[model samples]
Target: MAMRGVSHVEVFVRDKVSAVRHLRSSLGFAHVADCVEVDRSSALLRRGEVQVVATSGWATRAFIARNGEGVAGFAVTCDDVPAAEGAARALGAEVSALPRGRVTVTGIGDVAHTLLPADGHDPGAPPAGRRWVPRDGAWPAAGGAWALERVELRLPVALRERYPAFLSRVFGLERHPAQRSWLYSAPAGVTFALEEQRAPVPLEPPARAAAGSPPAASVTAYGLAFRALPAPVLR
Candidate 1:
């Protein structure tokens, strides 16, 4: 079966205010949600049909620091995990045991995914790739050459095989020798890629509301060229 289009791009941010401001002012993102949990703090913003999630989590800090500031993770909706998992394994992915409770599916690419039970997620909850659009506006633009595309992560270069293997296990992806990278497709013909960056950048400290709070800095963001961006402020 086909996988659903990207629901959203999740980012680890340093400053909630600055991240939100940058997306809203510099990139035209609109604030969607803001609040703090018992320990973590987070803010949601959107531009066009893409959702940008910024979270300040105690655990997420290390990931941001080690990986550098940039796109951290991606989410995809698939029809069947078992089948996809099989395909990924055939391609040399390193599959890990499923996690309890969360319906997790982990593999190499440093990618991890969870299945949304048949009942579905909450009403106003933000889906993975869909967060870029606002609650009110022109809505999302339609049709693109490739429904999804992403810039590759710049690993230590030493971790090339290791990273790709991880992706294979986690998302059930397959490496395309032709492209010299891994790829996976959803039932809808929407495809995602794991590319390689020329250089990797260092991670920055996250911004915070005050002392002893979660960091607010986002790792990094990739530019998506919509087949057509709306004229009247597309977010």
Candidate 2:
């Protein structure tokens, strides 16, 4: 089976409603779909080809409770979810079942994950009302608007080999030539680069000014960067 590269980035937040509003109003993202259950809420948002799955729940919130609100996991689209799950299991990923149509897996360092098959999975399409918005307009020569350029994974120093093997087994990601990392791609022009982190991890909320304060989005020791499209594609 030909598994696609990274299709979406999934974030675990405290409140899905507030996150949806904030992403739309402040971050220029538009909601594409909402999947809510008895205790969890997930909203899919898009800006250009970039998509995000923002979630909140007891299980999801555990990432926040332990690491604070930040990107908890990433998802790579696959030809078959069960096939991917089997591959992940072969690579030693901790696995679990999800309702409707999804599965969760964790590799070394317990990197959290969710597996969704390519068919019938509509986190919906890009929002209709808005155009794309670029942060700096420093679009790469690569013609595609909004491609995943890089992603950082804060893996435990010990579980180095297992993480890369897990990504390779599940997504067929090859090693990037320049960086000592894994790369996956799709026909739709999505690129995912995963780098193991080696910095001090911050568990508490980063320091803030005062009440009504918002901490800097750049505080986390680990992060992922997605390349943006040209101005025209955004529109």
Candidate 3:
């Protein structure tokens, strides 16, 4: 595959209407409805260099019903979409064609991913800090002072152990072994980490989580791994 790296991640939302607001204010993302999208008009939330697409209304409801609304899909930038699709087939993956310059490649859990053109980070150079306004004339307020850094893929204990190898095989990511989480460096600079789908084993107590949780997005919301901004001192 001529994979450059991750282009953008499509996070299905159980609550699309609210998710957009939370992403904007609570996470420092601006909801920019600028770029052209594939299949649907996605809610484009961007910050710094990170971009996330989420479908709205009925499409949002349907996908959430079937997949439980987390990061159901992500896109990888490649030299060519068709060639990457072929590469996915060579690796025994299920590939499907999508409209626009997108191609779906399967065999990674219930996640549906696609291959996109290897364009630079921001093709249009859309300015940052511009608030995304809705058709209804209402605008979401921005409050948080953090940017999206990385994303953590919460998987079942059984799947967590195997997913790193799967991504390595498919995306050609270099696996960087960590103490608890397994990190895979995408050629595009961002990383995809796999963590046990139990309670956050690193911080939260075991009691906070049930005995056996299903590998569903309902349990883990796909939010940014933020690096806290400097806090202002109160007088």
Candidate 4:
């Protein structure tokens, strides 16, 4: 019925060391898996309940030369692909078929979303949101920085205002609790915030983006997982 919150976000980086360090030491992300190819490498990382898929290769080099380290794309999970696909299509989103029960839902500015069908939910699972419960070595004092809170995407001035409504209509997102903000809440409590930057920032697609691909922006920053971030020394 509702779109599962963000499944994962892709980040493109030039230096895997610095990026991995920032995400791990600074942001409390833990490495899950990695892949190394002839000229590029990537790894999957996690913090709290969110997942970050980072890729580095030739496209990453071009991306860094152009716009620096940023998010390449994001994915979401839903119960019904046909309904979600239909919603995306009705809004002029370019829906592309993918192998293995996947679909790419492209929004304005060519925002790429790989949609996948969700697994059956457990009936007795705890309500999913920020977990304030204490975990050893998980606090800033214990060498933790922060967990990802939300995602921010800066769009063109022309499209900034309309996109949220578009998201609301298609993704079934509601306004973030902050009231009067650009943030929208996806199911499972994940959120996406939008803004119109002073200058139109280029959409920095992942280094693997196809040539002449639609112009797309990058994910600039992930919000703190908690509402109020703990005071810590940001290196």
Supply the global lDDT for candidate 4: 0.59
Regions of model 1 farther than 4 Å from truth: 85-102, 107-111, 115-125, 128-148, 154-159, 165-179, 182-235
lDDT (tens digit, per residue) of candidate 1 on 32-123: 75556665566666554555566666745665665544456555545555655565566665544343212344444444444432224332
CA lDDT of each prediction against the hidden true structure: 0.49, 0.59, 0.57, 0.59
186 Cα displacement, candidate 3 (Å): 5.6
Residues 181-226, candidate 2, lDDT per residue (tens digit)? 6555544354445544444354343233567876333222124454
Kindly report which residue stretches of model 4 are placed more than 4 angstroms away from their true locations once superposed.
37-40, 61-68, 121-148, 177-181, 198-235
Rate residue 184 of model 1 by lDDT. Answer: 50
TM-score of each: 0.57, 0.61, 0.61, 0.65
List the candidate 2 regions with Cα displacement exceeding 4 Å: 14-22, 32-41, 56-61, 65-68, 80-83, 96-103, 119-145, 186-224, 230-235
Best by TM-score: 4
lDDT string, candidate 4, 1-235, tens digits: 4677566777776667666766676445676556666677776666545567667888567544533456567777777777878888888888888765778877575346766677753311211222323224242221232334566555567776677876776677888778444565545566676754443244332234467775333222332233324566769
State the TM-score for model 2.
0.61
Sorted by TM-score, highest first, which candidate order results? Answer: 4, 3, 2, 1
